[model samples]
Target chain A: MGVFGHKTVSMTAKIRLYVDHPLGDGQTVPLDRDQAHYLFGVMRQQEGADVALFNGRDGEWLAQVTQAGKRGGELTCVRQTRPLQMPPDLWLLFAPIKKARTDFIVEKAAEMGAAKIIPVQTEYTNSERIRQDRLQAHAVEAAEQCGGTYVPEVTDLQRLDRLLADWPSTRRLMFCDEAEAGAARALGAAPRGPWAILIGPEGGFSVTERAKLHGLPFAHVVSLGPRILRADTAAVAALTVWQQALGDWDGPQSD
Target chain B: MGVFGHKTVSMTAKIRLYVDHPLGDGQTVPLDRDQAHYLFGVMRQQEGADVALFNGRDGEWLAQVTQAGKRGGELTCVRQTRPLQMPPDLWLLFAPIKKARTDFIVEKAAEMGAAKIIPVQTEYTNSERIRQDRLQAHAVEAAEQCGGTYVPEVTDLQRLDRLLADWPSTRRLMFCDEAEAGAARALGAAPRGPWAILIGPEGGFSVTERAKLHGLPFAHVVSLGPRILRADTAAVAALTVWQQALGDWDGPQSD
Candidate 1:
């Protein structure tokens, strides 16, 4: 929890912050054990030191530590630094891969403007064990690194069959079907509605999975390219393709 | 060498081969020490045993072990098995990243259908040290894993300036500009040509680098999406976009 627990704050390129709430009349905000360790032990924030703070919905604000300790720390929230970060409306749905590659996928997914990251287990998937906390933590860090206001939600891994069984009516699924030849131009040209890009696993979607996906009226079986791509590569590729084709551009689009 | 040295052959399905050639064919196709060790010690093939061989351009052939030792190993090329695996004609050009990510980039690049993998040193590139041979081996292994006939050649790290200075006349540079808003259609609508997808490193292109690249007549600045992609992600994303766009799309057309 050392570096991982650093509070996401809003500050200028170079600015100090205090965390005592202005509404609370300079009363120091209590730092949890994990947060205290991170600030004092890891980040080495001392008393009267400045740091940034931001609630997900609220604009970023500066804070300063009034008390420092190994196990306990306190800070005071001060003036505002910057406005809250607004994220794009992109959702990424990908078949899960191995643990390490899966983590990598989740991390990149969050950093890449995905409002939601959904994991679908396809027919060919072998490994099923997943630590949701680990994946969610990776997403949080990735969001912070990219300076995004919204952290993409890491939904539990669900079977493709079940997820598609009750597929949403409003959200269009840009199914990245490698088996689908070069019919992408036609499908891509007419894309509409809220979109999510679906990438298969390394072994690729089973014939049944592909067919199930094909039957969906909302599904756009988009192709990644001429050559076969690894599942993780396909995920990133599909996201890029979908973003260009229908994702929010220049931050948030009119949609 | 243990797992990678075995020349994995891909048939439409499983193949049964016969090895019959003059024991000594006066071929200087020397097996490296590693290959010899794997063939003689690891594989434990006898003096007369059937093995498969394919040299990308050359048709697949059956080869029999005539000599077996760690220092020297020889096999006589016999009857043909099947035609060689012809890979798609696509090249991947990416600026170097940290070592692990760079290796990941090369491995995934080969597995994903890159005919050639070139690592370029960009203006913001922090990695100056690269082992060409080691990286090349990674490409070979990736090809083997994906059952690809053509092992992409991982060229020595070339300066971006030097590479553009002598850019190929016929090859279309599909520049994957991260700052680009988005591709018209990721890969789907990418213009056709002898294509190369260029991915910049983490810190991104310097002003000078960007200007030089933009000035190139053959460069087509395309986007992956709205997000700020990492270097490795950008490489795969760019390649995917290229594959979708001008690649071998034999799908049903809109018309």
Candidate 2:
């Protein structure tokens, strides 16, 4: 069976669905009304059509639609297609900007292999609140679209100072300092176990916040380049830089 | 004067506007109706207020609003702020996706320092037409927001094959091959000078197109990572990788 290979499996089963239920051989998975409408009404996937399923825990499984209804549906797992390819132990900590841009950040983070996504509230951060559930949904959708077995968790908004005070010593922080813009401090030589990329808000980190971050032992201040990128662009750029330098981009899984 | 430095000049004059008129000491720049509305009606900028201005050719200039009105306004250039900082000789060739995502690709290309942006119509490209003017405006907005002196040109849609057939031999192409996903072909050793990053559409390129690109001697086929990325995410990631490896990210301007 070509089910063991990700590319081959996805080619055969075009639609990938993320479910909360477990996946295994011959396991029957139930789909909600929305999923039913999407498969039966939208995508028009009928009974006997193949669909890939993943639940963030189990490996991806090839499933065949057993019952397609207007309000609900069911699928029976054929076999494990691809093993759970966990993303690198990387987290993205970014200050939320506008509503749409914030969603873009989360979606990109998920597609780019971020293990966890946290929205931080710095002094210069404009948005005081974020819909964590909504962001998580975006992450899920991104994973579904990007052919990822794992979906990164999107945590609620947290105070930057509070999060840093109890920061894990072993987990390094890649601080994209705008003040140090155009600096040549790339992550090329940075040690890479349990890392997080911190992106500032539009106004950037306050002087006090910058001072605190600079003084932190685990903080590795770096610059994305000469230009002052908006918070959303910075998030994507930082994630890419970190991924290429220390994340899974060039890891053992990569050829 | 701190005006010559990008950081210092932007700090003093918060608003950065892109003007088509030439900028020099004691010269006056006429703002259009929309600009006047933004400066006076939206931002509430009054006469005597300082604003930073930049033309694509000229360097950034510090100007003071001399005349403020609803229909139009004028600003007198005080002095040259930051000198013209051109981006790397990079052209981003991408198959246009959705309207919003196409806009996103242009904005990010400008922010990430692409000298030119081209939307190529691949065999699988969905969008048949793109508003070059609207995309150009997005590039301008991105440059203004990112504090970039140069704005990349957004060219009209062109056929990918036609563009490739007349490809400049000196300009190497970084073809982001989704088919080669997980391949560890990092661009660390790729030659600099006049490079372009080619990103496929959501449906990806045709088999023949991929074969043709791989056969091209000037093309550097590379993979972003194991999992597939959306065209927009891939664009930003490819730009970041190329910038770090061979672009202006670590040149004389960097510390």
Each prediction's RMSD to truth: 6.5, 3.5
Candidate 2 collision pairs: A255-B184
- Give the per-residue lDDT of model 1 (tens digit) for B6-81: 1122343222221122222233244567777766677676677666655545544566677877797777766655
Each prediction's DockQ?
0.27, 0.40
Q: Which ten contiguous residues of candidate 1 chain A have the minimum total lDDT?
A: A1-10
List the lowest-lDDT window of 10 residues for candidate 1 chain B. B1-10
Residue-level lDDT of model 2, residues A1-255, one tens digit each, is 122111122356888999999999899999999999999899998999999899999988989999999999999999898889899989999988889999999998998899999999988777898999999999999888777899999999999999998899899999987567555345778776889989887666667888898999999988888776767777888887777677776654332
Q: Please, what is the whole-model Cα lDDT of each candidate in the order they appear? A: 0.65, 0.84
lDDT per residue for candidate 2 within B1-255, as digits (tens), equals: 112111222356878899999999899999999999999999999999999899988989899999999999999999987899998889999988888989999999998899999999988787899999999999999888777899999999999999999999899999887567544345777777789999887766667988899999999988787776888888988888788778877653231
* TM-score of each candidate structure, all chains considered together: 0.77, 0.93
Residue A223's lDDT within candidate 1 is 63
Every candidate's TM-score, chain A alone: 0.83, 0.92
